[model samples]
Target: MPPDSDPTEYKVGRLIDKYDLDGLGQELEDRWLGRGYESQSLRSLADWFNKYILEEKFNRAGEPPMDGEIDNIYRLLTDDEVTSGMRLDAETALEEKDIDPENTRKEFVSHQSVYVYLTEHRGASKQHSSKDRIGSARDTIQRLQSRLIAVIENHLEQLRNAGELTIGEFTVLIDIQILCEDCGSSYSLTDLFDRGGCDCE
Candidate 1:
């Protein structure tokens, strides 16, 4: 790809290479195309574009600069600063659930850390586990996920309104899992949250 290639024609990979984004391209690609290197779909491209602009580029606490351009838009999604704050919040949530956040932090060191922490710690004995406690933990995780989705959607809407992102409408899909370790079973976190608990017995 030429240095002067139209920014609109730049696919996720080319953009990553041109900007030296390293692992971000692969991570975005994986989220879009799974583990395969298949052709990019409109949904994937739009999803990536929205997230890159909203989360990585746009500032929530202040107005975006008037000089914001295409180059200014492309940024590293896994930039340590972004994930570090999320990691700290995940650690705090894990501690509230009586799970040792230190080991959980070390084990799942990515955006999925919250889900991983919950799955790893859902081992409370049937006799000892309180329904109320489980319910509270489930609420916490659900709230966290919901807040994330809301923030993304809010930013996407702002971009659409501002004419920054010109793509058609799209939805953000969050796939989170809750595991019943004792029974070797798994359920969607959304379902588990709705049902109030897993039917592991």
Candidate 2:
């Protein structure tokens, strides 16, 4: 899934539909039985569990969710919906500027909060500069977006090829990463996959 949606929602949904079932071994075999999903392998799922789920290396000890992390997720999901509103108001106050959507996208990507947003949502970084450019500035922004998407996609492919996660498990791992990055909270990898009470908190 892209970065604009709630990664938690995406991960949880996949867990319920795919990973939360019997015969996980069979399922893993089936995932690899066909060509593959995005070039992922069955071994990838095992590897992912071993690394992120079994190893539990997602966070530093004694960390808690931080401020503005929700805002970070919101920005990534809604293209900084809150920030865009605020900036539009500010732009109206300071100048006769019309709110350019492209400008807004660039601003969100450049914001310090973007790191938290990008790290978790796999494709959030791809949204950095995908607007149509009418002028040099817009064109420049598009170029940046193109380069960034390539890099992010490459990273995702590498993660997939590492043979450490299943498509389903990998999504959860990513969601955990994003949640941690956004909230600055450290969670055990086991705790993340645990369906006992893993609500958005």
Candidate 3:
């Protein structure tokens, strides 16, 4: 383990060991920390995990999965925007493969899980990120954004378990919108930053 590595064993680390996915940890670290590689967001990392690792694993199984079967089913089951019909179809598809939907669902992991695996378990660090003021601000905002989501998720789960509210699958939205009083127009925080400040005379 690296000197900066955290000692906690995360869920993703256990899953990696369970699947015998050798070299995956190093590859993820390389992609994240290697110089000259483009910066990766948690979303992109999630996509990479699903496509190159998870889906690929199923493709190599004793009984080859139908082309795109794993991707489609997994998406329908986990995607926040998916409809009820889509989820039902995914379950049916799993049944066709002689897989139990409920049990299989337990094996899926999210992008956040991948992040924890790489950071806490693998001791991966972002060695290539810019260290300038603007870069630091951007990184701080990104992490805080993630923490905000996690906090809300935990509180919502607690409420559900306490029977304080009745809710189904939900999406969490945290849009920071700024209204330009001069122009009487609204813009997202990111858009404002990207445009180098709102257009004004």
Candidate 4:
């Protein structure tokens, strides 16, 4: 007599072989085959993977070394160079109008956080004599954005090549968000994949 053939059993066996999940496989086999859970086999296994294995096992198996890159980019964007350019322009304006530089700078820093200030001001005033400084700062920001995206995409490509993840799976895991430099618009990974990048000119 041949052994009983079950599709869920086959799938579980394959997962065990592929991932070397010896202990979990034994537990699952005992629960589904030995116990009376054969009817709910696949669902039970899927729930297990979702609740425990996805983060605990699968993510740990293939984590990349991109945290440092991300941190570097974030720090560059928020560094004093960028903030000082804005401060200098504001200071110039305040000084021209005979306002107290020290007190006004403190007030500006307190009222407007770095991100809010950068997004709101964009660059120095057109009439101010810091046009070059503004242009340089904008260029630096654009470069950093491009570099960050490139680093992330390269890492994703490596993971895909290693067969650790598919592009779809990777996108879901990362939940990527892109910012359009020209239009200051934000996009999701799904939106980028579906629509082929932002619609900025």
Best by lDDT: 3
Model 1 ranges with Cα > 4 A deviation = 1-131, 179-184, 192-201
My TM-score estimates for the predictions, one after another, are: 0.28, 0.19, 0.59, 0.21
Residue 133, candidate 4: how far off, in angstroms?
A: 80
lDDT of 1: 0.45
Residue pairs clashing in model 4 are none
Q: What's the ranking of the predictions by TM-score, best on top?
A: 3, 1, 4, 2
C-alpha-based local distance difference test score of model 4: 0.40
lDDT for every model? 0.45, 0.34, 0.62, 0.40
Output the worst ten-in-a-row residue range by lDDT, candidate 3. 3-12
Ranking by lDDT: 3, 1, 4, 2
- Count steric clashes of candidate 1: 0
Off by over 4 Å in 3: 1-8, 34-39, 51-61, 128-134, 141-201
For model 2, residues 1-201, the per-residue Cα lDDT tens digits are: 343545333332233233343433233333333324342222244333222211111121222224643234323334335566665554443233233333333222221122233334333222223452223342354345545655765677677789764453221112223145555655433234322223446
Candidates 2 and 3 compared by TM-score, better number: 3
Candidate 1 lDDT over residue span 1-201, tens digit each = 112333222233333444455666334444433446553332334434444433332233233434542222222222345566665664454345454444322222223322222222222111224656765665576457746866887899899999998866554546677789887767666456546667766
